[model samples]
Target chain A: MSPDEVHYPGAVPPARTRFVRSLGLRLHVCEWGDPDGEPVLLTHGFYDHARSFDLLAPLLAERYRVVAMDARGHGDSDRPDAYAWFPGLIDVVNMLRDLGRPAHVVGHSWGGGQATDAATLHPGSVRKLVNMDGFGPPEEGFHVPGRDRDERPAPGQLAGWLDWRVANHSRETFRPCATLEELAERRRQQNPRLSSEWLRYFAAHGSYHTPEGWVWKVDPMAARNIGPFRPEWIAPGWARLRAPMLALVGSEPDTWGPLPEPMLARRLSHVPKVERGVIPGAGHFMHIEQPEAVARIVLDWLEAG
Target chain B: MTRLRDGRAELALHELGSGAGPTLLCLHALYGAGSDFRDLAAAWPGRVLALDFPGHGHSPRSFGGSYTPENLVANADVALAHASEAQLVGAGLGAYVALLLAGARPDRIGGALLLPGRGLAGGGAEPKRAEPEGMSHARFDVLLQGITADADPDPMLENCDRDIRPPDYARAHADSARLLLLAEDDAERPPWWHAVREADCAEVAPADPEAALARLAAS
Candidate 1:
């Protein structure tokens, strides 16, 4: 289905919604395509929900059973008191086990990194791994020194940091927007390539309407950094992956900062078996910007290997 | 990780070190699990038991969905019952909970070292910070991952409580055998630091567990 042919930009094709109990949280899951088809699991990045695959899942449904998960603290998933990476990796592993067989996994951004860890740490659970621009900073970029560095507490200063964070963020509040259209307009200003209709659809699903106004569904605390996320911590997972992997990045740089060629190469070198490709004229949100192109690339890779 | 049944909730307890010295029950702050005290436990002179408070870390969320001080205290009570006679070392919200337990059952708590608990002053103004314009989800994740790895303060949490009132400190102040560790140059101080001092709550710098131990020995 082409973007233009979609009469309901926000309408996701009929899918069954279910909750999976894992890691002490209820994970919201969406199932599309045929149950008999080969399973292909999709994971969205931070602050995004499973519905993010609406534009791409339909295209893959003809040949694969598409399942998308709303990671804990995002979308319809339950928000945990604290957020961490290892717990998320465990959740993915558990989901795969629940599926009862190895499945193809596709992850975007944060989810991409998690998918990499899943395929690497639990090779038996993942058949194939597709990373959509989820390679984080270069090895040297783990700690962005000087910028907001003071916010971080020293080795013995976690108590102070917790006090500061709780004192600052534990309150209940929402950003007031005039309407859903206004929120979509704000989103459009950031993603110029995304059509207004698609932006509205994304906003409708991504935000909640309060009596006062509309606000994002994501928990603000999910954005906080309560633990470690260094390259060393992530590289081991990448190095251990036994599944064939594909890395898809946008040819044009957009947001995720800029991944220089050398940096990208250095990061990808950890993956044992991997291939790389890029979508032209698309940025970080390449799947949304060029779903057809992304779908074609993913389908071709899945079919080839 | 030790699991204990606390009513309907399950508490994950992390234990470390083994010595003749008094057991140091380490309690972590909000948004933190008992694991946050790993380094502290390693450095302590005695056995250390850290607990993942209900709804945080591996501990299951409270059945009532209440994170109120009373509920947290009840969970802490369950954890405290499992440990031998111990000194209490708590940071952030953990500090507050520790003080509450100490106040309710001073006989069980040999001493309490509170790491600049929540009732101190300051942090009233909205922090002058801005989310970068046009930040994508990937960019945000990068920033978050960096901070998480570094154990740095998150900008997103900077001004979230600008309008909310600080937690009340009367109970903590009334607790017995409590010593407060005031970190140097802290950006966030309890609203009642001066009051705590006026009440003769022994205070130290940077909330050093070793120093608190020494002070307790002297006392």
Candidate 2:
């Protein structure tokens, strides 16, 4: 089916799309709101494109100029030869550079972590920080906090990741979905809390049509695992952040994140100035599920002293 | 230079000399390319193959500085697949990979000759403050000087920028057929250098380059 045939009932289209070059790759940046207004950068989570913020961006755009980027290897951005955590943060910095001024930054899921690190690493580039459930998984392997020595990964575990990369690289092409609904169903499997209508909207923007079928626009190789990363390592940087942070997560449980309260509290304790909130009756994708509510919270926070 | 693929990774492999002896696979250090071994390959009596790891030389860069040790080893394995009987000769990061391959593919790798340089001791599992805020044009140019000649400095810089877990050297030790060679008077040897048995190490001496390498290859 043609792309025009796909539709989202109440979605608001981006006002303009701009491309910014960073590290030799051209990144697609979607814009909304008045050009003269203060900029608010929106970053989406993993497996999501800039358009994932279609509902939220418009609401925030009411008072601020919103720029949402399709991070490298996602949406219309150029795919890099590899995807490492540092480069993603660099992309955020470059986007701020393009804005030519410090802007309030809002990131969801993986983007939230990028926003946090970007603010910490390059303080002057961001005025305020808002992160939505971007903290990594709460499991021991990923979030082990105070260990004296750096532990080596089991040889088998390392080998298994390498083997997986090798096998993933061997695939001739991405798996094809017969229809857009099929794509939405796949996303629903991971995000069952989201309504089917919203998943369809997400899938439409996140994928493109091919002669064979529809496939996600994201680079399959972007999913390749990096060497060991622990959340505890991010604590030092969090403690150094100059901008006040607002951490938000949905009250409802979902498949991926919104780490447990005690663990979340411990991680948040590292930040110097942080305000925490739980979006009631929402899951990981709170903005999509309740845009008006999230917007009210975000707008009030940004407008405050 | 020949291009070979292991999964989606494209590697540039350079070959020199041909004889009945086992093929010597030369791996270069971080930012160094396969051509760095051209002089040695010409000197060796047996066949010699040098490979440009991904993001360096002719091989395509993996985006986002994905130069983790596992990724490097996996890409290097593609070159290993080409040789029927091979011995690994590596310096710096190359040496670390050689030690890993020696452990991972004992059947394919008969022995490994490890030399010292950057990446000799793998970045500890969690590297502290590994990321540079951003690289300026002048700063990048300064880094390129004397560090890399034939490859792009970006990937090399990316490779150097992360905290990577060291490979299980114990796995490499299981082979017991490898040697770690160091300079006689070198003072900055890795802390783990002494842990390698004395019998498995050779101190470089004033001798013919070919004879020394051939002697090392034979063990």
Candidate 3:
């Protein structure tokens, strides 16, 4: 019952509930507040947890059934040593359907992508859709449109960067001391390599060691998995999603970089009824970095309708 | 590799490094997943394994079940099946579970170290009425400023959300009550009290300090 129970990723309070999800797998889901309340399915970022919605879930759960699920292989959910993209989408859809009532879908990253998938795949299943930093599909032909203008490497060219990333970022890997203020103070000193806003995500998601230092709980494999996701697989999925969406982009490009705003609009233009454009000051993983800002956007969108 | 033993819920473990070096199996503090102890394991160059306690880390949720001391110890037993023998080290709140492992089953632990740990089963649960109220912002602000490296308050204070820490502390006290499973706490107590007094069963060392405890542990 205490906030500590569901220790999902980041700064959110741990999750607490009997059955958050049941997709044949013992899905460890987190539901807050009353059962009969207005339900909202909270989808978190990759490597992040249900608690990432900590600040806002409590506020929302006060009136709605704020349900946060730890996607399979990420948090407390079973990491069955196997992964599949499409079946995973249905798992989320069925899990929400299992909620005993319809729910608004709010997803971030993979979850955001899945929320949109769930909405378009089963449009009636979701109410409001809040897609934070989740605009994908590449607009066609494996080309990230105008990226050549910047002269940056290809979108998925990640191999050469990992060792460089691990060696350098490991020390800078966000490990906010158990001290929040101290954790925040450390935030000011966030490595220049990462965005200031993205630095906040490090603060919210990192854990501590009694003697050594703070540790980021993300499996190193987390970011690496993306390199292999073929564009062919990514593009087809976009054709299935048409939910009303919000494209949130973090301010810092080097760190919170998203699909170029033009690229985002290009890909999302298919949705027909899109409430488009990006929110200010958010990065890829916006919630932990700026819970208030992220929550405000979701809340405002929820109220608009 | 960490395997979630079939049929045993929340009983999972990961083992790393092997050879002459003794294995070290670690359990993270409550509300913390098992991976929380990865840093502590890094402190020791020897082989190590960190297990997620049932319900907290990679393990299954307790589901109306409690993470009681006995349940925790049982989870430890199942998780450490790979490390039949090894030195054990527990940090912060995790030390309490280590105490139980060492005291209840001494033959398994080559050595045990508990840091910043109070008795696992002491002063029964803080009575409901006695819990302290929210910290004043001024006090919280001052407390925030006071955290330092050597006297680092983050891990110790942020051991977890306050609600879970006490019961976690209670579990540690339970181990203390078992004489063979207990050890010195004062700045003066021997470092390996359980080994000397309970294991080898000898009057080997004085609780004065490290050198003494090392000598005592050696004897």
Candidate 4:
């Protein structure tokens, strides 16, 4: 959030920061729990920055080392903004290599898949996997059928949005929450974490703030294209996954319904050590809707080991 | 008297396909109609009931209540009466109604595909999204322009009384999905991320047209 931005639930102070070096991109992270405790890493989903997990991080941090990261194109991480996939996964793998020890991994939705693959992509960096809802099989064209795709959000629209973000936000959009407590509160209300930020970011970054409010950050004319990505061919890449896994899905899947057969086949095909289940009363946004259930599920799994 | 006032108002209706298959009832996003999700119907199972939302396409004029959630759901309730059962699929505005309907009468809707849509905390009298202080009105107006410039805003905004919106076009407004998505992403294990956390973005994506809507009938 841009500094001085007061939000609901209540006001949250920001936090002090620290980071690590590895991969081409910088790793922006926040920590909780005892540094000396067991290292348990938490990764956010697409467009979500790491702090959104503040609420859940500490709960688990009490017993373990909790580290949450913001994925690229999201949060404070380098916005490569390039049209790429698994390639980013490799970077995380390399970052883990720097950690020197295979870390227990958890990922929700997109992050789940990344964690699942990171175990396979790097092999040595991950020990156990709490795949969350990310355990669904790779999209048929996991990375979209067309390699040379350009489905980037409308650059003009994006620019207009950016225009708004730049004008509204100062340097603080890059800053972490004022304090862990505040970050946790923000996380409780802000869920998936990106939409709220992006709306502001887009308003801040996509538009120009004049005397009134803000506008789109991009030109609003930035062209965008869609694709039919194919992930089946890329299935072989995930074959080396070594992490014992858990596939957590919402009680109600959107349209895909209960794990499509093919997707399920892909998950277990290579990583024979995979567990699948659901969070009661949770929908697509299971963790946000039922974080306790999710946390309990994660904690239980960790205790099992 | 022939009980003229008793009727909800005259409505045209149609039901296609009698085959035994899953049933899908698709609702369009703001400025869209049920037909918009039609493409998803082909790949899905059973029959499909696509209808125009109350104010758009061939649907009736906004009665006493216009574009609010209540009205949207009511329009859908009437539309769904044409079928025995259906998996509900809604996009954008339609998705909001779908969720409301699903919650209100879960039995009526087998399942739902609420594509990137507006949740409870969406566009209204108050700007749900936080914009740069001064330019929100203009920026919002332009957004209204962008949405309505392509479609129709008079009825759109008229039926729905919200200042930030022009009543002309559709806007991406939803609070739950945004938070849900964030919460959804945070479930990763042994977790520690390096990217920005707790960002205050307000815009959300339109729900997947077919992925959510199409699946309701297919399954």
Interface DockQ of candidate 1:
0.04
Q: What is the Å distance of residue A143 in model 2 from its true position? A: 13
The per-model lDDT (C-alpha) reads 0.65, 0.74, 0.51, 0.48
Model 2 misplacement above 4 A = A141-154, A170-173, B5-10, B39-45, B54-66, B103-107, B119-125, B129-152, B155-162, B166-186, B189-219
What would the DockQ be for model 2? 0.30
- Candidate 2 docking quality: incorrect, acceptable, medium or high: acceptable
TM-score winner between candidates 2 and 4: 2
Location of the lowest summed lDDT over 10 successive residues in candidate 1 chain A: A152-161
Compared to the true structure, candidate 2 yields what TM-score? Answer: 0.84
Give the per-residue lDDT digits (tens) of candidate 3, residues B96-148.
Answer: 56655554454455556554343332223332223233223354334324422
Chain B TM-score for all candidates, comma-separated: 0.69, 0.75, 0.55, 0.56
| DockQ scores of the candidates | 0.04, 0.30, 0.01, 0.01
Name the 10 consecutive residues with the lowest summed lDDT in model 2 chain B.
B166-175
lDDT per residue, candidate 2, A217-273, as tens digits? 888877655544656665555877878999999999876678888988888887889
Q: Candidate 4 chain B, which ten residues in sequence have the lowest lDDT sum?
A: B189-198
True-vs-predicted CA distance for residue A262, candidate 3, Å: 1.8
What is the C-alpha lDDT profile of model 2 across B1-219, one tens digit per residue?
888986656788988667777799988888788888888777676889998887678877754445666667777777887885688888778876776666556556766766666666555545445343434435544533423343456544545534454333433343344444443344564433444434343345325657657765675
Name the weakest run of 10 consecutive residues (lDDT summed) in model 4 chain A.
A219-228
Q: Mind giving the per-residue lDDT tens digits that candidate 4 earns over B10-107?
A: 33333433346777677776666555654666666567677665546665543322245544554466566556566666765565566445543444
lDDT of 4: 0.48
